[model samples]
Target: MTDYFWDFDGTLYDTYRGMVKSFVIACTESGFKVESDQVYKSMRRTSLHQTFAIFLKNVDFKKKQRIVTRYETVEKSEQTNDRPFKGAAEVCKWVIEQNGRNFLVTHRNKSALNMLKRDQFTSLFTGCVTSENNFPRKPNPASLNFLCDQYQVDKDNSFMVGDRALDIEAAHKAGIKGILFDPDDIIFVETVPDKRIKSLLKIIV
Candidate 1:
Protein backbone atom coordinates (compact mmCIF):
# COMPACT_ATOMS: atom_id res chain seq x y z
CA MET A 1 0.00 0.00 0.00
CA THR A 2 2.52 2.55 -1.03
CA ASP A 3 1.18 6.08 -1.28
CA TYR A 4 2.20 7.86 -4.47
CA PHE A 5 2.63 11.44 -5.60
CA TRP A 6 2.65 12.02 -9.38
CA ASP A 7 3.93 14.78 -11.60
CA PHE A 8 1.37 15.71 -14.21
CA ASP A 9 3.26 17.29 -17.09
CA GLY A 10 5.75 15.23 -19.09
CA THR A 11 5.54 12.29 -16.72
CA LEU A 12 1.85 11.55 -17.11
CA TYR A 13 0.62 13.87 -19.80
CA ASP A 14 2.30 14.48 -23.19
CA THR A 15 2.41 18.23 -22.68
CA TYR A 16 5.85 18.95 -24.10
CA ARG A 17 4.72 19.61 -27.63
CA GLY A 18 2.08 22.04 -26.50
CA MET A 19 4.50 23.71 -24.13
CA VAL A 20 7.04 24.28 -26.87
CA LYS A 21 4.40 25.67 -29.18
CA SER A 22 3.12 28.07 -26.54
CA PHE A 23 6.60 29.20 -25.58
CA VAL A 24 7.56 29.86 -29.17
CA ILE A 25 4.39 31.81 -29.72
CA ALA A 26 4.92 33.89 -26.61
CA CYS A 27 8.52 34.74 -27.45
CA THR A 28 7.62 35.51 -31.03
CA GLU A 29 4.93 37.89 -29.87
CA SER A 30 7.49 39.52 -27.62
CA GLY A 31 9.74 40.14 -30.70
CA PHE A 32 12.09 37.22 -30.24
CA LYS A 33 12.61 34.62 -32.93
CA VAL A 34 12.71 31.45 -30.93
CA GLU A 35 13.39 28.27 -32.84
CA SER A 36 11.10 25.34 -31.96
CA ASP A 37 13.78 22.66 -32.09
CA GLN A 38 16.14 24.70 -29.94
CA VAL A 39 13.43 25.33 -27.36
CA TYR A 40 12.53 21.65 -27.30
CA LYS A 41 16.14 20.63 -26.90
CA SER A 42 16.76 23.02 -24.01
CA MET A 43 13.49 22.02 -22.34
CA ARG A 44 14.62 18.40 -22.34
CA ARG A 45 17.51 19.27 -20.01
CA THR A 46 16.47 22.47 -18.21
CA SER A 47 13.60 24.27 -16.58
CA LEU A 48 11.45 26.75 -18.49
CA HIS A 49 12.99 29.72 -16.70
CA GLN A 50 16.50 28.61 -17.54
CA THR A 51 15.54 28.03 -21.13
CA PHE A 52 14.10 31.52 -21.37
CA ALA A 53 17.08 33.07 -19.67
CA ILE A 54 19.41 31.45 -22.16
CA PHE A 55 17.55 32.48 -25.29
CA LEU A 56 16.13 35.77 -24.14
CA LYS A 57 19.30 37.10 -22.54
CA ASN A 58 19.03 40.45 -24.25
CA VAL A 59 15.30 40.89 -23.65
CA ASP A 60 14.42 43.48 -20.99
CA PHE A 61 12.56 42.53 -17.83
CA LYS A 62 9.30 44.10 -19.02
CA LYS A 63 9.48 42.24 -22.33
CA LYS A 64 10.20 39.00 -20.52
CA GLN A 65 7.13 39.59 -18.36
CA ARG A 66 4.98 40.01 -21.44
CA ILE A 67 6.37 36.81 -22.93
CA VAL A 68 5.72 34.83 -19.75
CA THR A 69 2.23 36.28 -19.40
CA ARG A 70 1.47 35.32 -22.99
CA TYR A 71 2.83 31.83 -22.45
CA GLU A 72 0.65 31.28 -19.39
CA THR A 73 -2.41 32.54 -21.17
CA VAL A 74 -1.80 30.27 -24.12
CA GLU A 75 -1.06 27.30 -21.90
CA LYS A 76 -4.41 27.68 -20.16
CA SER A 77 -6.36 27.87 -23.38
CA GLU A 78 -8.79 25.11 -24.40
CA GLN A 79 -6.73 23.80 -27.31
CA THR A 80 -3.75 22.97 -25.10
CA ASN A 81 -2.73 19.34 -25.33
CA ASP A 82 -3.75 17.33 -22.25
CA ARG A 83 -3.41 13.76 -23.41
CA PRO A 84 -1.98 11.31 -20.90
CA PHE A 85 1.23 9.48 -21.63
CA LYS A 86 1.17 5.82 -22.65
CA GLY A 87 0.10 3.55 -19.77
CA ALA A 88 -0.13 6.47 -17.33
CA ALA A 89 -3.78 5.88 -16.51
CA GLU A 90 -3.11 2.17 -16.24
CA VAL A 91 -0.43 2.82 -13.63
CA CYS A 92 -2.83 4.88 -11.55
CA LYS A 93 -5.43 2.14 -11.82
CA TRP A 94 -2.79 -0.35 -10.82
CA VAL A 95 -2.12 1.60 -7.63
CA ILE A 96 -5.82 1.63 -6.83
CA GLU A 97 -6.20 -2.08 -7.52
CA GLN A 98 -3.28 -2.80 -5.23
CA ASN A 99 -5.06 -0.91 -2.45
CA GLY A 100 -2.54 1.92 -2.60
CA ARG A 101 -3.34 5.61 -3.10
CA ASN A 102 -2.20 8.23 -5.60
CA PHE A 103 -2.22 12.02 -5.69
CA LEU A 104 -1.06 14.74 -8.07
CA VAL A 105 1.62 17.33 -7.33
CA THR A 106 1.99 19.69 -10.25
CA HIS A 107 2.88 23.30 -10.95
CA ARG A 108 -0.30 23.68 -12.94
CA ASN A 109 -3.31 25.13 -11.18
CA LYS A 110 -6.96 24.55 -12.12
CA SER A 111 -5.75 23.42 -15.52
CA ALA A 112 -4.60 20.17 -13.99
CA LEU A 113 -8.03 19.48 -12.57
CA ASN A 114 -9.69 20.43 -15.80
CA MET A 115 -7.50 18.04 -17.78
CA LEU A 116 -8.13 15.21 -15.33
CA LYS A 117 -11.85 15.75 -15.56
CA ARG A 118 -11.74 15.91 -19.32
CA ASP A 119 -9.77 12.69 -19.48
CA GLN A 120 -11.92 10.97 -16.83
CA PHE A 121 -8.92 10.62 -14.51
CA THR A 122 -10.16 12.72 -11.61
CA SER A 123 -11.39 9.79 -9.54
CA LEU A 124 -8.00 8.09 -9.78
CA PHE A 125 -6.41 10.56 -7.36
CA THR A 126 -7.02 11.08 -3.65
CA GLY A 127 -6.20 14.79 -4.09
CA CYS A 128 -3.94 17.20 -5.90
CA VAL A 129 -1.35 19.85 -4.98
CA THR A 130 -1.44 22.61 -7.56
CA SER A 131 -0.24 26.17 -7.91
CA GLU A 132 -3.67 27.38 -6.83
CA ASN A 133 -2.98 25.75 -3.47
CA ASN A 134 -0.31 28.43 -2.95
CA PHE A 135 2.51 26.06 -2.18
CA PRO A 136 6.07 26.73 -3.28
CA ARG A 137 7.11 25.07 -6.56
CA LYS A 138 8.96 21.77 -6.95
CA PRO A 139 12.22 21.06 -5.12
CA ASN A 140 10.79 23.06 -2.18
CA PRO A 141 8.90 20.12 -0.61
CA ALA A 142 6.19 22.36 0.81
CA SER A 143 3.38 21.02 -1.38
CA LEU A 144 4.57 17.43 -1.16
CA ASN A 145 4.84 17.82 2.60
CA PHE A 146 1.33 19.20 2.74
CA LEU A 147 -0.06 16.28 0.78
CA CYS A 148 1.80 13.81 2.97
CA ASP A 149 0.31 15.38 6.10
CA GLN A 150 -3.17 15.58 4.60
CA TYR A 151 -3.22 11.96 3.53
CA GLN A 152 -1.40 10.71 6.60
CA VAL A 153 1.05 9.03 4.26
CA ASP A 154 4.21 7.58 5.74
CA LYS A 155 7.23 9.03 4.02
CA ASP A 156 9.08 5.70 4.16
CA ASN A 157 6.24 3.94 2.33
CA SER A 158 5.66 6.60 -0.30
CA PHE A 159 6.99 7.41 -3.76
CA MET A 160 7.03 10.44 -5.99
CA VAL A 161 7.16 9.66 -9.72
CA GLY A 162 8.00 12.37 -12.20
CA ASP A 163 9.90 13.24 -15.39
CA ARG A 164 12.34 15.87 -14.18
CA ALA A 165 15.17 16.31 -11.65
CA LEU A 166 13.09 18.85 -9.76
CA ASP A 167 10.49 16.19 -9.07
CA ILE A 168 13.07 13.78 -7.74
CA GLU A 169 14.66 16.54 -5.67
CA ALA A 170 11.30 17.52 -4.24
CA ALA A 171 10.57 13.95 -3.21
CA HIS A 172 13.95 13.74 -1.53
CA LYS A 173 13.24 17.00 0.25
CA ALA A 174 9.99 15.52 1.50
CA GLY A 175 11.82 12.49 2.87
CA ILE A 176 10.33 10.11 0.33
CA LYS A 177 11.82 8.05 -2.47
CA GLY A 178 11.64 9.32 -6.02
CA ILE A 179 11.15 7.42 -9.24
CA LEU A 180 12.40 9.05 -12.40
CA PHE A 181 10.30 8.26 -15.46
CA ASP A 182 12.73 8.47 -18.32
CA PRO A 183 11.14 7.00 -21.40
CA ASP A 184 13.85 8.39 -23.64
CA ASP A 185 16.80 7.48 -21.40
CA ILE A 186 17.85 11.11 -21.70
CA ILE A 187 18.95 11.49 -18.10
CA PHE A 188 22.50 10.23 -17.81
CA VAL A 189 23.20 11.70 -14.41
CA GLU A 190 25.31 9.74 -11.95
CA THR A 191 22.45 9.69 -9.47
CA VAL A 192 19.27 11.62 -8.87
CA PRO A 193 16.37 9.25 -8.29
CA ASP A 194 15.94 6.31 -5.98
CA LYS A 195 14.45 4.36 -8.87
CA ARG A 196 14.14 4.70 -12.62
CA ILE A 197 11.49 3.37 -15.00
CA LYS A 198 11.37 3.58 -18.77
CA SER A 199 7.67 2.93 -18.92
CA LEU A 200 4.75 3.42 -16.59
CA LEU A 201 3.98 -0.32 -16.57
CA LYS A 202 7.42 -0.99 -15.11
CA ILE A 203 6.40 0.70 -11.87
CA ILE A 204 5.32 -2.45 -10.09
CA VAL A 205 4.14 -2.44 -6.52
Candidate 2:
Protein backbone atom coordinates (compact mmCIF):
# COMPACT_ATOMS: atom_id res chain seq x y z
CA MET A 1 0.00 0.00 0.00
CA THR A 2 1.09 3.55 -0.63
CA ASP A 3 1.29 6.43 1.78
CA TYR A 4 -0.22 9.66 0.47
CA PHE A 5 0.94 13.12 1.52
CA TRP A 6 -1.62 15.81 0.78
CA ASP A 7 -1.50 19.58 0.61
CA PHE A 8 -4.06 21.38 2.69
CA ASP A 9 -5.10 24.67 1.06
CA GLY A 10 -6.35 24.50 -2.54
CA THR A 11 -5.82 20.74 -2.59
CA LEU A 12 -8.03 19.06 -0.02
CA TYR A 13 -9.61 22.22 1.31
CA ASP A 14 -11.17 25.06 -0.71
CA THR A 15 -9.44 27.99 0.96
CA TYR A 16 -8.93 30.25 -2.03
CA ARG A 17 -11.89 32.46 -1.29
CA GLY A 18 -10.79 33.18 2.25
CA MET A 19 -7.15 33.45 1.33
CA VAL A 20 -7.74 35.70 -1.66
CA LYS A 21 -10.07 37.88 0.34
CA SER A 22 -7.43 38.17 3.03
CA PHE A 23 -4.81 39.12 0.48
CA VAL A 24 -7.00 41.79 -1.03
CA ILE A 25 -7.85 43.18 2.37
CA ALA A 26 -4.23 43.16 3.45
CA CYS A 27 -3.00 44.81 0.29
CA THR A 28 -5.63 47.51 0.50
CA GLU A 29 -5.07 48.18 4.19
CA SER A 30 -1.31 48.29 3.73
CA GLY A 31 -1.57 50.75 0.78
CA PHE A 32 -0.50 48.18 -1.79
CA LYS A 33 -3.45 48.74 -4.14
CA VAL A 34 -3.65 45.43 -5.95
CA GLU A 35 -6.50 44.17 -8.06
CA SER A 36 -8.43 41.34 -6.47
CA ASP A 37 -8.26 39.32 -9.68
CA GLN A 38 -4.50 39.77 -9.84
CA VAL A 39 -4.13 38.67 -6.25
CA TYR A 40 -6.27 35.58 -6.88
CA LYS A 41 -4.47 34.72 -10.10
CA SER A 42 -1.00 35.16 -8.69
CA MET A 43 -1.79 33.18 -5.55
CA ARG A 44 -3.25 30.28 -7.48
CA ARG A 45 -0.47 30.22 -10.06
CA THR A 46 2.70 30.97 -8.10
CA SER A 47 4.47 30.89 -4.73
CA LEU A 48 3.64 33.30 -1.92
CA HIS A 49 6.92 35.15 -2.39
CA GLN A 50 6.24 35.56 -6.07
CA THR A 51 2.71 36.67 -5.32
CA PHE A 52 3.92 39.39 -2.95
CA ALA A 53 6.74 40.40 -5.25
CA ILE A 54 4.32 40.87 -8.10
CA PHE A 55 1.65 42.77 -6.20
CA LEU A 56 3.71 44.63 -3.65
CA LYS A 57 6.56 45.48 -6.00
CA ASN A 58 9.36 47.78 -4.80
CA VAL A 59 7.75 47.90 -1.36
CA ASP A 60 9.82 48.16 1.79
CA PHE A 61 10.19 45.32 4.28
CA LYS A 62 8.01 47.05 6.87
CA LYS A 63 5.16 47.41 4.38
CA LYS A 64 5.47 43.74 3.51
CA GLN A 65 5.33 42.87 7.19
CA ARG A 66 2.25 45.00 7.61
CA ILE A 67 0.53 43.22 4.74
CA VAL A 68 1.42 39.85 6.28
CA THR A 69 0.05 40.87 9.65
CA ARG A 70 -3.19 42.11 8.16
CA TYR A 71 -3.51 39.00 6.05
CA GLU A 72 -3.09 36.82 9.14
CA THR A 73 -5.79 38.71 11.00
CA VAL A 74 -8.20 38.37 8.09
CA GLU A 75 -7.35 34.71 7.57
CA LYS A 76 -7.89 33.82 11.21
CA SER A 77 -11.21 35.62 11.28
CA GLU A 78 -12.35 33.76 8.16
CA GLN A 79 -10.83 30.38 9.02
CA THR A 80 -14.10 28.70 9.79
CA ASN A 81 -15.34 29.28 6.25
CA ASP A 82 -12.56 27.26 4.70
CA ARG A 83 -14.14 23.91 3.90
CA PRO A 84 -12.71 20.84 2.23
CA PHE A 85 -13.52 20.11 -1.35
CA LYS A 86 -16.10 17.51 -2.24
CA GLY A 87 -14.84 13.92 -1.74
CA ALA A 88 -11.81 15.02 0.27
CA ALA A 89 -12.88 13.38 3.50
CA GLU A 90 -14.22 10.36 1.67
CA VAL A 91 -10.98 9.84 -0.23
CA CYS A 92 -8.96 10.06 2.97
CA LYS A 93 -11.15 7.46 4.59
CA TRP A 94 -10.84 5.27 1.50
CA VAL A 95 -7.07 5.35 1.75
CA ILE A 96 -7.25 4.00 5.28
CA GLU A 97 -9.67 1.28 4.18
CA GLN A 98 -7.18 0.22 1.54
CA ASN A 99 -4.47 -0.07 4.18
CA GLY A 100 -2.71 3.03 2.94
CA ARG A 101 -1.49 5.84 5.11
CA ASN A 102 -2.70 9.42 4.71
CA PHE A 103 -0.55 12.28 5.90
CA LEU A 104 -0.64 16.07 5.54
CA VAL A 105 2.24 18.40 4.71
CA THR A 106 0.99 21.97 4.64
CA HIS A 107 2.29 25.50 5.08
CA ARG A 108 -0.49 26.13 7.56
CA ASN A 109 0.02 26.06 11.30
CA LYS A 110 -1.69 24.06 14.08
CA SER A 111 -4.94 25.77 13.22
CA ALA A 112 -5.12 23.42 10.27
CA LEU A 113 -5.62 20.65 12.82
CA ASN A 114 -8.62 22.49 14.24
CA MET A 115 -10.20 22.72 10.78
CA LEU A 116 -9.54 19.03 10.17
CA LYS A 117 -11.12 18.10 13.47
CA ARG A 118 -14.07 20.35 12.74
CA ASP A 119 -14.54 18.48 9.49
CA GLN A 120 -14.07 15.10 11.22
CA PHE A 121 -10.82 14.44 9.32
CA THR A 122 -8.29 14.74 12.11
CA SER A 123 -8.25 11.00 12.82
CA LEU A 124 -7.62 10.04 9.20
CA PHE A 125 -4.03 11.23 9.08
CA THR A 126 -1.05 9.38 10.51
CA GLY A 127 0.61 12.75 11.11
CA CYS A 128 0.72 16.31 9.87
CA VAL A 129 3.77 18.48 9.16
CA THR A 130 2.80 22.11 9.31
CA SER A 131 4.60 25.47 9.16
CA GLU A 132 4.88 25.54 12.96
CA ASN A 133 7.11 22.45 12.70
CA ASN A 134 9.93 24.74 11.48
CA PHE A 135 10.94 22.72 8.43
CA PRO A 136 12.06 24.45 5.26
CA ARG A 137 9.26 25.25 2.85
CA LYS A 138 8.36 23.04 -0.11
CA PRO A 139 10.56 22.56 -3.21
CA ASN A 140 13.28 21.93 -0.55
CA PRO A 141 12.06 18.45 0.49
CA ALA A 142 13.19 18.70 4.14
CA SER A 143 9.67 18.55 5.58
CA LEU A 144 8.62 15.79 3.24
CA ASN A 145 11.78 13.90 4.10
CA PHE A 146 11.04 14.36 7.79
CA LEU A 147 7.49 13.03 7.40
CA CYS A 148 8.73 10.02 5.42
CA ASP A 149 11.31 9.25 8.06
CA GLN A 150 8.79 9.56 10.87
CA TYR A 151 6.40 7.16 9.19
CA GLN A 152 9.12 4.87 7.81
CA VAL A 153 7.53 5.30 4.39
CA ASP A 154 9.01 3.76 1.28
CA LYS A 155 9.65 6.56 -1.19
CA ASP A 156 8.70 4.39 -4.12
CA ASN A 157 5.38 3.61 -2.46
CA SER A 158 4.54 7.16 -1.52
CA PHE A 159 3.15 10.15 -3.41
CA MET A 160 2.88 13.87 -2.82
CA VAL A 161 -0.45 15.20 -4.01
CA GLY A 162 -1.00 18.92 -4.30
CA ASP A 163 -2.14 21.79 -6.49
CA ARG A 164 1.22 23.50 -6.99
CA ALA A 165 4.52 22.89 -8.72
CA LEU A 166 6.40 23.18 -5.41
CA ASP A 167 4.52 20.13 -4.25
CA ILE A 168 5.61 18.06 -7.25
CA GLU A 169 9.15 19.45 -7.06
CA ALA A 170 9.37 18.55 -3.39
CA ALA A 171 8.21 15.01 -4.13
CA HIS A 172 10.79 14.67 -6.88
CA LYS A 173 13.46 16.07 -4.60
CA ALA A 174 12.54 13.45 -2.04
CA GLY A 175 12.65 10.68 -4.69
CA ILE A 176 8.91 10.05 -4.54
CA LYS A 177 6.13 10.17 -7.10
CA GLY A 178 3.74 13.14 -7.36
CA ILE A 179 0.13 13.67 -8.26
CA LEU A 180 -1.07 17.12 -9.31
CA PHE A 181 -4.65 17.90 -8.48
CA ASP A 182 -5.43 20.36 -11.25
CA PRO A 183 -9.17 20.52 -11.45
CA ASP A 184 -9.02 23.96 -13.08
CA ASP A 185 -5.92 23.17 -15.18
CA ILE A 186 -4.55 26.56 -14.11
CA ILE A 187 -1.09 25.19 -13.47
CA PHE A 188 1.24 25.14 -16.45
CA VAL A 189 4.47 23.35 -15.61
CA GLU A 190 7.35 21.72 -17.43
CA THR A 191 7.69 19.00 -14.78
CA VAL A 192 5.19 16.27 -15.54
CA PRO A 193 3.85 14.32 -12.61
CA ASP A 194 3.37 10.58 -12.15
CA LYS A 195 -0.34 11.30 -12.06
CA ARG A 196 -2.61 14.28 -12.82
CA ILE A 197 -5.89 13.93 -11.05
CA LYS A 198 -8.83 16.33 -11.33
CA SER A 199 -10.70 15.00 -8.35
CA LEU A 200 -9.75 13.59 -4.98
CA LEU A 201 -11.72 10.43 -5.83
CA LYS A 202 -9.32 9.78 -8.69
CA ILE A 203 -6.60 9.01 -6.15
CA ILE A 204 -7.35 5.34 -5.77
CA VAL A 205 -5.03 2.54 -4.70
Candidate 3:
Protein backbone atom coordinates (compact mmCIF):
# COMPACT_ATOMS: atom_id res chain seq x y z
CA MET A 1 0.00 0.00 0.00
CA THR A 2 1.11 3.55 -0.68
CA ASP A 3 1.51 6.09 2.08
CA TYR A 4 0.38 9.66 1.60
CA PHE A 5 2.05 12.15 3.92
CA TRP A 6 0.28 15.50 3.99
CA ASP A 7 1.01 18.87 5.51
CA PHE A 8 -1.86 20.25 7.50
CA ASP A 9 -1.47 23.99 7.87
CA GLY A 10 -1.02 25.19 4.31
CA THR A 11 -1.55 22.12 2.22
CA LEU A 12 -4.56 20.07 3.22
CA TYR A 13 -6.32 23.00 4.82
CA ASP A 14 -6.48 26.74 4.25
CA THR A 15 -4.75 27.71 7.50
CA TYR A 16 -3.15 30.93 6.28
CA ARG A 17 -6.26 32.81 7.35
CA GLY A 18 -6.02 31.57 10.91
CA MET A 19 -2.26 31.97 10.99
CA VAL A 20 -2.64 35.61 9.95
CA LYS A 21 -4.74 36.32 13.04
CA SER A 22 -2.38 34.34 15.23
CA PHE A 23 0.73 35.92 13.79
CA VAL A 24 -0.65 39.38 14.28
CA ILE A 25 -1.61 38.58 17.84
CA ALA A 26 1.81 37.13 18.58
CA CYS A 27 3.80 39.87 16.88
CA THR A 28 1.66 42.57 18.38
CA GLU A 29 2.09 41.12 21.85
CA SER A 30 5.82 41.23 21.26
CA GLY A 31 5.50 44.88 20.14
CA PHE A 32 6.35 44.11 16.52
CA LYS A 33 4.06 44.44 13.56
CA VAL A 34 4.72 41.67 11.08
CA GLU A 35 3.56 41.29 7.51
CA SER A 36 0.89 38.57 7.60
CA ASP A 37 1.67 36.80 4.32
CA GLN A 38 5.40 36.74 5.00
CA VAL A 39 4.92 35.33 8.48
CA TYR A 40 2.46 32.75 7.16
CA LYS A 41 4.87 31.70 4.42
CA SER A 42 7.72 31.36 6.88
CA MET A 43 5.62 29.31 9.25
CA ARG A 44 4.16 27.01 6.63
CA ARG A 45 6.91 26.63 4.03
CA THR A 46 10.36 27.32 5.34
CA SER A 47 11.74 27.88 8.82
CA LEU A 48 9.39 28.77 11.65
CA HIS A 49 12.28 28.77 14.10
CA GLN A 50 14.11 31.31 12.01
CA THR A 51 11.06 33.57 11.81
CA PHE A 52 10.50 33.39 15.57
CA ALA A 53 14.18 33.90 16.19
CA ILE A 54 14.11 37.12 14.18
CA PHE A 55 11.14 38.38 16.15
CA LEU A 56 12.63 37.35 19.48
CA LYS A 57 15.96 38.97 18.73
CA ASN A 58 14.30 42.36 18.55
CA VAL A 59 12.40 42.05 21.83
CA ASP A 60 12.93 41.03 25.44
CA PHE A 61 12.56 37.33 26.19
CA LYS A 62 9.66 37.86 28.59
CA LYS A 63 7.66 39.76 26.01
CA LYS A 64 8.55 37.21 23.39
CA GLN A 65 7.29 34.47 25.63
CA ARG A 66 4.07 36.38 26.08
CA ILE A 67 3.77 36.68 22.32
CA VAL A 68 4.34 32.98 21.82
CA THR A 69 1.79 32.21 24.48
CA ARG A 70 -0.72 34.52 22.90
CA TYR A 71 -0.15 32.94 19.51
CA GLU A 72 -0.77 29.51 20.93
CA THR A 73 -4.08 30.62 22.36
CA VAL A 74 -5.09 32.68 19.36
CA GLU A 75 -4.29 29.82 17.01
CA LYS A 76 -6.37 27.42 19.02
CA SER A 77 -9.34 29.79 18.99
CA GLU A 78 -8.95 30.37 15.25
CA GLN A 79 -9.08 26.67 14.45
CA THR A 80 -12.67 26.83 13.36
CA ASN A 81 -11.68 28.54 10.16
CA ASP A 82 -9.13 25.94 9.13
CA ARG A 83 -11.34 24.14 6.67
CA PRO A 84 -10.15 21.60 4.12
CA PHE A 85 -9.71 22.69 0.53
CA LYS A 86 -12.40 22.05 -2.04
CA GLY A 87 -12.27 18.44 -3.31
CA ALA A 88 -9.49 17.61 -0.84
CA ALA A 89 -11.80 15.41 1.16
CA GLU A 90 -12.66 13.57 -2.02
CA VAL A 91 -9.00 13.21 -2.80
CA CYS A 92 -8.42 11.61 0.58
CA LYS A 93 -11.18 9.15 -0.17
CA TRP A 94 -9.73 8.50 -3.60
CA VAL A 95 -6.32 7.74 -2.15
CA ILE A 96 -7.89 5.28 0.23
CA GLU A 97 -9.60 3.65 -2.71
CA GLN A 98 -6.18 3.24 -4.27
CA ASN A 99 -4.94 1.35 -1.19
CA GLY A 100 -3.06 4.26 0.33
CA ARG A 101 -2.61 5.41 3.89
CA ASN A 102 -3.11 9.08 4.67
CA PHE A 103 -0.86 10.73 7.22
CA LEU A 104 -1.34 14.29 8.41
CA VAL A 105 1.94 16.10 9.15
CA THR A 106 2.11 19.42 10.92
CA HIS A 107 4.34 21.59 13.09
CA ARG A 108 1.31 22.49 15.14
CA ASN A 109 1.26 21.87 18.90
CA LYS A 110 -1.05 19.40 20.67
CA SER A 111 -3.78 21.96 21.24
CA ALA A 112 -3.93 22.68 17.53
CA LEU A 113 -4.09 19.00 16.66
CA ASN A 114 -6.86 18.55 19.18
CA MET A 115 -8.73 21.38 17.53
CA LEU A 116 -8.59 19.46 14.21
CA LYS A 117 -9.87 16.37 15.94
CA ARG A 118 -12.77 18.38 17.29
CA ASP A 119 -13.31 19.97 13.90
CA GLN A 120 -14.13 16.60 12.20
CA PHE A 121 -10.99 15.90 10.08
CA THR A 122 -9.69 13.39 12.58
CA SER A 123 -11.56 10.59 10.87
CA LEU A 124 -10.11 11.56 7.52
CA PHE A 125 -6.54 11.08 8.69
CA THR A 126 -5.10 7.76 9.82
CA GLY A 127 -2.13 9.24 11.70
CA CYS A 128 -0.90 12.67 12.68
CA VAL A 129 2.65 13.94 13.27
CA THR A 130 2.87 17.13 15.26
CA SER A 131 5.58 19.18 16.95
CA GLU A 132 4.15 17.93 20.23
CA ASN A 133 4.71 14.39 18.94
CA ASN A 134 8.44 14.94 19.49
CA PHE A 135 9.68 14.62 15.93
CA PRO A 136 12.19 17.12 14.67
CA ARG A 137 10.57 19.88 12.57
CA LYS A 138 10.10 19.58 8.80
CA PRO A 139 12.98 19.30 6.33
CA ASN A 140 13.92 16.48 8.71
CA PRO A 141 13.35 12.82 7.81
CA ALA A 142 12.77 11.52 11.30
CA SER A 143 9.04 12.19 11.38
CA LEU A 144 8.33 10.88 7.88
CA ASN A 145 10.35 7.75 8.62
CA PHE A 146 8.23 7.19 11.72
CA LEU A 147 5.06 7.37 9.64
CA CYS A 148 6.53 4.94 7.12
CA ASP A 149 7.36 2.49 9.86
CA GLN A 150 3.93 2.76 11.40
CA TYR A 151 2.12 2.29 8.11
CA GLN A 152 4.54 -0.28 6.66
CA VAL A 153 5.10 1.80 3.55
CA ASP A 154 8.16 1.69 1.39
CA LYS A 155 9.89 5.02 0.88
CA ASP A 156 9.95 4.70 -2.91
CA ASN A 157 6.21 4.13 -3.15
CA SER A 158 5.28 6.90 -0.71
CA PHE A 159 4.42 10.47 -1.63
CA MET A 160 4.29 13.64 0.45
CA VAL A 161 1.92 16.43 -0.50
CA GLY A 162 2.88 19.76 0.97
CA ASP A 163 3.13 23.43 0.04
CA ARG A 164 6.71 23.84 1.16
CA ALA A 165 10.29 23.11 0.21
CA LEU A 166 10.83 21.41 3.56
CA ASP A 167 8.39 18.72 2.49
CA ILE A 168 10.44 18.00 -0.59
CA GLU A 169 13.64 18.00 1.46
CA ALA A 170 12.22 15.58 4.00
CA ALA A 171 10.79 13.30 1.31
CA HIS A 172 14.05 13.25 -0.59
CA LYS A 173 16.12 12.47 2.52
CA ALA A 174 13.78 9.62 3.40
CA GLY A 175 13.94 8.15 -0.15
CA ILE A 176 10.29 8.94 -0.78
CA LYS A 177 8.88 10.90 -3.70
CA GLY A 178 8.58 14.61 -2.89
CA ILE A 179 5.75 16.20 -4.79
CA LEU A 180 6.02 19.91 -4.10
CA PHE A 181 3.02 22.24 -4.41
CA ASP A 182 3.75 25.89 -4.95
CA PRO A 183 1.90 28.26 -7.24
CA ASP A 184 4.99 30.28 -8.08
CA ASP A 185 7.25 27.31 -8.88
CA ILE A 186 5.22 24.97 -11.02
CA ILE A 187 8.29 23.80 -12.85
CA PHE A 188 8.61 20.14 -11.91
CA VAL A 189 12.16 18.91 -11.64
CA GLU A 190 12.65 15.31 -12.81
CA THR A 191 15.58 14.54 -10.54
CA VAL A 192 14.94 12.02 -7.72
CA PRO A 193 11.43 11.32 -9.01
CA ASP A 194 10.21 14.53 -7.33
CA LYS A 195 8.00 17.02 -9.10
CA ARG A 196 6.63 20.48 -8.32
CA ILE A 197 2.93 21.04 -8.82
CA LYS A 198 1.10 24.30 -9.21
CA SER A 199 -2.26 23.17 -7.88
CA LEU A 200 -3.82 20.25 -6.05
CA LEU A 201 -6.32 19.81 -8.85
CA LYS A 202 -3.42 19.12 -11.19
CA ILE A 203 -2.23 16.08 -9.19
CA ILE A 204 -2.31 13.47 -11.93
CA VAL A 205 -3.84 10.04 -12.03
- Computed on alpha carbons, the lDDT of every model, listed in order, comes to 0.85, 0.87, 0.74
Of the candidates shown, which would achieve the greatest TM-score relative to the real structure? 2
- In model 1, where do residues sit more than 4 Å from their true spots? 78-80, 188-191
C-alpha TM-score for every candidate: 0.91, 0.95, 0.86
Q: Model 1 clash pairs?
A: none
lDDT of 1 by residue, 40-94 (tens): 7677666676888998888889888888899988877733456998898999998
The residue-by-residue lDDT of candidate 2 on 1-205, one tens digit each, is 8889999989989998898899888988766677777777787778666787887778888978888888889999898899998889888888898899999999889888899999889899998899899888888899999988888999999899999988998999999999999888888767788899889888863
lDDT of 1 at 176: 96
Model 1 global lDDT (CA atoms, 0 to 1) = 0.85
Off by over 4 Å in 2: none
Q: How many backbone clashes does candidate 2 have?
A: 0
Q: Candidate 3, residue 152: CA error in Å?
A: 1.4
Task: State in Å the error of residue 96, model 1.
Answer: 0.7
Worst 10 residues of 3 by lDDT: 184-193
Tens-digit lDDT track for model 3 on 86-181?
656777777788878789888776754676666676776788888878988877889988988887787778899887777777888888888776
Q: What is candidate 3's TM-score against the reference?
A: 0.86
- Candidate ordering by TM-score (highest first): 2, 1, 3
